[model samples]
Target chain A: MPTKTVAGTTVEVNDEGFFTDPSQWTEEMAPELAEAEGIDTLTDPHWTVIRFMRQEFEEKGTGPTVRALGKTSGVTVKELYQLFPKGPAKIAARVAGIPKPRGCI
Target chain B: MTHRIVILGAGTGGTLAANRLRREYSTDEATITVVDQDDVHVYQPGLLFVPFALARPDDIVRPRQDQLHDHIEYIQSPIEAVEPDADRVHLTDGTVLDFDVLVVATGAALLPEETEGLTGPGWGEKVHTFYTLEGATALRDSLAAFDGGRLVINVVDMPIKCPVAPLEFAFLADWFFTDRKMRDSVDITYVTPLDAAFTKPVAAKRLGGMLAERGIDLVTEFNTGEVDGEGGRLVSYDEREVPFDVAVVIPLHGGQPYVGRSPGLGDALDFVPTDPHTLQSQSRPNVFALGDATNVPASKAGSVTHFEGDVLVENVSRFIAGEELDASYDGHANCFIETGFGKAMLIDFNYDTEPLPGHFPSKVGMPLLKESRANHLGKLMFQWFYWHALLPGRDIPGIGPDMPTTGKRSPESESP
Candidate 1:
């Protein structure tokens, strides 16, 4: 495990830089995390997706897949790609401060 | 008064659980009943070898009831819905089965129709799947007729039964075409929604390397949104397209339809929300689930169901006896990866660990994560074991419910 500073707060993360303790995340860290992944600004749409991801993780104990997020997160699949870019499921999960979606290897 | 234990679905999990329960409780103690829509049990794993003409459809088919203990009752009826509140299961034929405890083992169902244009123009012709018996049989004919072109194998989504089967199909296809003397003319590609060849890091790297070594192109993170079989194209949600002459698609899989009808019993995908360790349904204490039917984050493979059988039987007994349920199941899952040319690889791991290298069970046992002829022989021998020992709930010698860590060499233990 490794710790990193984001928004003046230290948080634990895994080898892939995903948050180990989601409780350490705050709304203030969202912009910095998003920027670290190449997103410069946090729009309302981004918050909507991020909030939905956190809620889903809290309920299901895992983050939603791209398919599930697209279907239930009030966001279209195309929009998710534009919002998160490259890999919506993985990238958004990191920024949302939830564990990676385990689709069962 | 005898306790009534009703098990839904007579597939691998239900059949073995029923058998193991029978041995645990005598006929005077409990009456075990297993139900499924039909008696046909098509040794699901063997379906993987069908497209390569290695297995005949007829050879794998068997009556599901034949696998159960004679003392257990087997019913043939479609499940209507589970009234968990009433402690009963409703059958489509207007029959209600009451039980002291219920096991929801109805496995995953293939939903190819869910994808747009998948079953449209060239479905059974140019585009086929080997996940089902009919699909595999159809694919066998299609592969035989295929001379040369791009043959793409696409996995529509994840959490599928035997997640490694598609990779196995790709490896076998390479060997199949080469054996037919048309390897040069055929270009093979594997497309998956995952960012890697597999979910786990160690195994994914090895499998990806094998795909590259075999000259099979690997396309990752391509979430297939539609299958335009008529146009011979697979379109991803990201607006990327992978064209193919023959497409073998592993369609999205979900739990049995009846799971959806039964409220408070399943997740959005209809898979029972089960406690991963205890194998008990999160919905109700008396209702339990295993196999591909449960949303347990473990690989949906038969070996998982087999391992889960031991813990499930114990917990069911404990629940019936008004004792504490055993939280012993560690999500142990293993698979024999068929890596072409009479050689295969074995991977064993549990919830806490990913598949690692070294031998299994013990250091002297078959090699793990590395291809070997012995592992391939073990793979072939498992078929016999599945029917004779596994389905009957006989404890396999040296193999136990929990994953053994003795022989496995963790990355930290390896010499730099």
Candidate 2:
């Protein structure tokens, strides 16, 4: 296993062909990895909220709540649902490349 | 023995395959027969740029049969059934064409009616889709006549033709309105079901920034529940409302109608379950499909089709030769996206790769996933290449359907 650092998180890559550690994850990595997973198009508006969440986590050192992220990002809860079908916590976790946040449940 | 090759739908894939195969094989060795309901071959991608008046309607479209080889018989009729086991195609006109090999290129069709109230009261009034030639022309007129209000360019769902088209329309709308000095008057919002203006991350980040720069409103994750024409509102199932004075929507797309008529031909959307690499139909050995008709988890773009065309032509020939099928479609698809204001963005990827920031084909070629003046010129030049080289079954010297690893920046591997 090769251990590396991304966004200041200790990332591990297993021989099972995984590249980086999941803990090193951030919302910024979601769109990039998702496309590698076969997402064809990644347009602009998706970045607006993702970037907002990335900045929030960086400032507070904790994931922002769906309500808080939505408010700051100018995205509504309903709209956020459509944006992240798996829910905000899951999206943030995927982007953050970490486990789902505790309060997300 | 002249082997019979039956093709369904005379669209890009079918027509191109016919021409390519004819050039590769002698007429005496194999006979090609193409079946379709109409003879009109609409250059679908041109539909996106049409509303901007960049493409003349007549130039982008041609008779379906006109592009094929003269030796290939073109039957203008709808397909009623496809017997994959028998390698046969039954037309709506009660004619059944049997073949030693069957190629299903019956591409996708737009079904705006799939969305509730989308086609009802707002049919052509205030709600318009530029996915069709008729819709594009009408929207051009509507846009030209209007002083401006709330103009929304929306995508009803994912997997629509030319994924970046709606955004292009918004960018161009900005240019269009600014040219008229009505840019500030008309609020241009791009409404999409996905989280961002785009589906990928890096590009989405850059594009979102572009939208902000251009003052185009990015309305994300809006799954349209209903188009309330009288109310002039697009309501999501969750009760979010997007009010628009003029809406340009890219509607839900479905597979060819003939797929619905034939058993085991397609899924609910009429897209065939295809081997992601070989472009062979999962149902039968003799049947192969590509482009928008296959549910191969690839972009439904012409570039994908062009690349798939190369793989498909080879696979079809291999099937005829009874050789072991080479499952080798690297899922290479590249597209030139018009970003408006004399520029465009180009992206290249395959099944496992996300479009990375690098030079394409080589460091000398167009920039990948980056907007550049040269890329925009390439986009414009493609129209000439499309009519003269691509359709005529002539291969470009430098370009191949497979994505080139050389001259591209790979995060995974270090330089040798």
Candidate 3:
């Protein structure tokens, strides 16, 4: 596992830079992770999605998919793309310190 | 009192479980009943080949009850709802069947209506799907009439049954057009909501490379918001557009509507909240689920259902006998991926392991993660096996529920 410094804190991450140990993630790490993924700032809407993702991951053992994030994360699917840009489910999970939402291959 | 087992769906999981359970218990000791909405049990795997005209639609379907053991009771009635608390099932025909154990195997249903304009102007004309018998047949006609232009294969969302089927359809389409001597006039593009061609990393990389090599364009992370079939464009949630001359779209899938009707039965998607390892429903002690009906994070493929049958049958029996349930199911799943022409690739994996490059069953058995004519032959031969060995619950020689690792090579081993 590779370790990276985000927000002055060293955290373990996978090959794709998603947190290997989600417990190492702090609320302060969200802004830096967001910036790493090309987002300029951590706005209130971004935090709402990030917090929802974290809570969902804690409860379900996995982050919600883009559809689930849009439906239940209090963010519209259009707004999700506006907030996260390219991949909402993936980028939001990264900032929230959760594993990538997987589909069976 | 005789132990009553009511297995719903009568599809792959339900039929196999019924047959296996029947063999375990005599009719005097237990009564096995299987229910489904209809008698036609279409060989779902064959649906993948239907659009390509490789398999006839009529040849792939059979009477559902014919597959079950004679001792097992078969009911043809649409399920109304499952009263889990009362251990009763209400059918649309007004029959309420009581059971000591209930197995929910009612598989996923395709919902094209969920997306705006998907079922609009050119639904059966320009935009088509191969996920259903009707869709596959309609797509066959559409593809036959299609001579040229941009042909896009779009997957609407994830967790769809046979996740690799859409990819198979694309590969076969390349072969189909080439066979017709019209390969040049056609441009093939594969669109998906995922970040890659597939979910697993190794398989994705391998499959993605194959797509590029075949000159099939891959558009990833595209969350389709609407299908403008009349205008011939797919509008994403982000407003990115992928224009198509004809679109083969795999629509969003959810569990049967009856699952949602039953309170405390299913998740947001209507897939039963199941214990992934145990194959038991989280809602009630006597309730269990398998196959596409459960939100178990496994591929919704027939092989997964076949592999799961062994564990699910055992656990169902255990629950009835007042014994400990077996939690041995390790999310084992395998699929034969058709890669056009006369070759196909095989992949075998389980929970905690991604599809790797190696042989399956044993080191010398068959090539894994690489296209081979032998795997293609295996794919062709599986239809016969599906009817004879698989649905009857007979044990396949040398293959068990657990994923075999003997022939597999790990990434770490290769790196060192």
In candidate 2, how many Å is residue B402 off?
1.1
TM-score of each: 0.94, 0.80, 0.94
lDDT of 1 by residue, B120-186 (tens): 9999999999988999999999999998999999999887899899999999999999999999999
lDDT of 2 by residue, B306-363 (tens): 8888888998999899987778788787888777778888888887776777878888
lDDT of 3: 0.91
Supply every candidate's count of residue pairs whose N, Cα or C atoms clash at under 3 angstroms. Answer: 0, 25, 0
Q: Model 3: per-residue lDDT, tens digit, B1-416?
A: 79999999999999999999999999998999889999999999999898888999999999998999889999899999999999999999999999999999999999999888999999999999988899999999999999799999999998899989999999999999999999999999999988899989889999999999989999998899999998999999888999999999999998999999998999777889999899999999999999999999789989899999988988987887799998999989989999999999999998878899999889989899999999999999989999999999998787788999899999888565
**How would you encode candidate 2's per-residue C-alpha lDDT over A1-105 as one tens digit per residue?**
666544455567444324334435655556665454343444565666666655665654455555455446777655666666545544644554543332210
How well does chain A score by TM in each candidate? 0.96, 0.59, 0.95
The candidates' DockQ values read 0.53, 0.03, 0.48
- lDDT-better candidate, 2 vs 3: 3
- Would you list the rank order by DockQ, best first? 1, 3, 2
* Best-performing candidate as measured by DockQ: 1
lDDT (tens digit, per residue) of candidate 1 on A1-105:
799999998899999989989999888899999999999998998999999999999997889887778768999877898899877888898998887777565
**What's the iRMSD of model 2?**
14.2
In model 3, pairs of residues that clash are none
CAPRI level of candidate 2: incorrect
| Top of the candidates by TM-score | 1
Off by over 4 Å in 2: A1-105, B410-416
Once fitted onto the true fold, the runs of candidate 3 whose alpha carbons sit more than 4 angstroms away are: A1-17, A21-47, A102-105, B413-416
Error of 2 at B355 (Å): 1.3
Which residue pairs overlap in candidate 1's backbone? none
